[model samples]
Target: MLTYLVSPDDSALDHYPLLGNALAFWRSTIQQRQPFCPACRASFAEEAQPAAFLFATAAIAPTSASVSAFCMACWNDLPPAMIEREATRVLQQVIPGGRFLDPCEARR
Candidate 1:
C-alpha cells in the first residue's frame, strides 16, 4: 500500500506524482468551503472552526481514478491498522484494478 502525508509542510505531488489533479480538486473543495468527510459525509463548515487537517487519497489506475477526503477528527480517531485497512478498502472501491505504486512508508 502507498502512503502519503498531506500537510501544509509538504507538496502533494512530491509524495504522489499522480496526485496533481487530485490535489487541485482538494484545493478547490477547500476554497469553496465544501470540504466533507468521505467516511461520514459530515460538512466541515459545521465544525465551528476550520479543519485541523485534510486527509485525502486518490486511487489511480491506468484507466480509472477517484479521490476522497476525511476530516481530522475521524482520521485521528482511527488506529494505524484501521487506517491502512480502510485506505486499502477505499482504494479498491475507487480503482478496482489499481495497485498503489508509490512508496509504502508514510512521508512525514
Candidate 2:
C-alpha cells in the first residue's frame, strides 16, 4: 500500500469520494457506500490493482492527538488530520454539563 498522499487535482476528488472515519463507516455501511482511493481505483479484478491502501485513523481534534488505528480492510481512508477534525467536531456537540450516555461494555 502507498504510504504517502497523492497530489491529485481537486477535480480528482470529485471523481473520488473520501471515506470518513472507519468505525463510523463500518457501523453504517448500508447508509454510505465505501469509497476507493483514487490511486487504487480498479474496475476489473482480472487486471492489476493499485499499491495504495487506506486506513482508519482515530484522533482527538482541536487537541490534534491520535488515539487508534486500523488497516484499510478494517477501516476507511481516515487520515490523522481528518480524525482530529472529526474528534473536535464531536467534542463540540457534546454538552459540558449535560447528560451523556455510554453503552454497556458487556453489550459489545
Candidate 3:
C-alpha cells in the first residue's frame, strides 16, 4: 500500500520573490480606495436641501480610467453632448470627474 501526505508551509508568504510580488498585488487591490469629489474639486456638505452631486459606481478593467460626479445643478446645466446617457447604468468607479455636467446657479 502507498499513501501521500501534504504539509502546510506559510513560509510561502516570503518563500520567494514571486510570492512577495503576489502579496503586494493582493494588498494593493484590497487596500485600494477611491474618493469622490475631493474637497479641492467639490464639496460634500449640504444645507436646506442644497443640491447634491449624484455619484454612481462601476467596475472597469483598464489602467487609465476615470469617473464623474453630477450635482442636481451640474446635471441640469450640462450640454446634451456632454452627458453620456449610455453610461448612466454604469457606476462611477473612479470619481475624478470626466466630461463633467457643469454646475449652475439656478435651481431646477
Candidate 4:
C-alpha cells in the first residue's frame, strides 16, 4: 500500500478523477472490469498471480485523503515517505476528498 502527503495548495485534487471518498473510490474500482493497482498499474487478478493486490488510503491532509491500490511487490518496496506512520498523523487522516485515476483511463 502507498500513502501520499499531498498539499491542498498543490491542487492535488485537480489531477485525478475525484470519487468523493475512500469508500466511493473503492466501489468504483470493483465496478471496473479489470482494475489495476494505481501505484504500479499492475492488473489486479487472483492472489496467486503477481498482479494481485489491495487498496489503501493515502493521507492528503488532516481531514482529507485519497485511495490507492498497490500490487504485492510494489507494496513491499514502498519508500519511507509513502509508508503511513504516526509522525505524519496530521497528514494521514482518512476523511474525504479522495481522488482516483483509473488505470484504463490513464492510458489515454
Candidate 5:
C-alpha cells in the first residue's frame, strides 16, 4: 500500500492528474479552517502530519472532483478499493458535479 502525505505546501495537482481544481477547493477549505477528511471527518492540524492512502477510481471526469484523504490509521487498516469507494461517495455529497478518477489513467 502506498501512503501520501497531504500538506498545504505540496500541490495536489502536481501529484495527480484531473485534480488541480479539487486541490484548489481543498486549499480554500483549509484557509477557512475547515480542512477535514471527507471520509473520516478528521480535522487536519497544520503542524501535524497526516497520511492518506492513494488510489484511483473508475469514473472519468475532466477534473479530480474527489480524493480520499484518510488518516494514517485508517489508511493502514482499510483496503485501497474500499477507501476509493468511500472517498467517491463522500465527494458526491460535498462537491457539486464531482467525478472520480482512475489512478491507472494518471499521467506518468
Candidate 6:
C-alpha cells in the first residue's frame, strides 16, 4: 500500500503519482462519493468548521476503508470517550472480525 499526504493547497495530481493523474478514473470508480457524518448523517459537502475526522486504521483496506466524520454538534456534545466508542462502533460495522489495537499496544 502507498501512503501520501495531499495538502489542501497542493494539487491531487501532484501527490498521487501512482494514480497516473487519472482523477476522472478514480472518481468514476470510487463508491460512496459523498461523505457524511456517521453519527448524524450530516452531509459533508462543504467544509465543516468544527468537525471531527476519525480514521479507522483497523478498517483500512484496498476494498474497504473507514473514515467516520462527526459534525460540530456531535463533536461538542459528546465526551472524548463517547466519541471514540462511537467511532469504534461504526468501524466494527465496516470491518467485521477486524482486530483493533490500542495506540500504546501498536507502538510496542
The candidate with the higher lDDT, 3 or 6, is 6
lDDT of 5 at 90: 61
Candidate 4: segments with Cα more than 4 A from true spot: 1-32, 46-68, 83-108
Off by over 4 Å in 2: 1-76, 95-108
Q: Which structure is stronger by TM-score: 4 or 5?
A: 5
Ten contiguous residues minimizing lDDT sum, candidate 1 = 48-57
Model 3 stretches astray by more than 4 angstroms: 1-40, 47-68, 85-108
User: In terms of TM-score, which candidate is stronger, 3 or 6?
Assistant: 6
Provide the lowest-lDDT 10-residue window in model 4: 46-55
Tell me the tens digit of each residue's lDDT in model 2 across 9-99: 2244244333223223433442244333232332212233222222222222231111122224212455656544443433334433322
**Tens digit of per-residue lDDT, candidate 4, span 1-108:** 234433223344456434235434544565474655555556654341222212244334234334444556655677645533222332234434333445599679
Give candidate 3's whole-model lDDT: 0.32
Could you arrange the candidates by TM-score from highest to lowest?
Answer: 1, 6, 5, 4, 3, 2
Model 3 clash pairs?
A: 56-92, 57-91, 57-92, 58-91
Per-residue lDDT of model 5, residues 1-108, tens digit only: 122335434666476754555555655676476565555677664532346533333444433344445665556677877776766566565555665655677554
Which candidate, 4 or 6, would have the higher lDDT against the true structure? Answer: 6
The lDDT leader among the candidates is 5
The TM-score of candidate 6 is 0.48
Task: Put down candidate 1 lDDT per residue, 4-60, tens digits, no spaces.
Answer: 545433564566555555555655676476766655567754662222233334333
The lDDT, on a scale of 0 to 1, for candidate 4 is 0.42
Locate the minimum summed-lDDT window of 10 residues in model 3: 1-10
| TM values, all candidates | 0.49, 0.20, 0.24, 0.30, 0.44, 0.48
Which residue pairs collide in model 4, if any? none
Q: The CA-based lDDT of model 6 is what?
A: 0.50
Q: Give the Å error, residue 68, model 2.
A: 13
- Candidate 1: residue 39 Cα off by (Å): 3.4
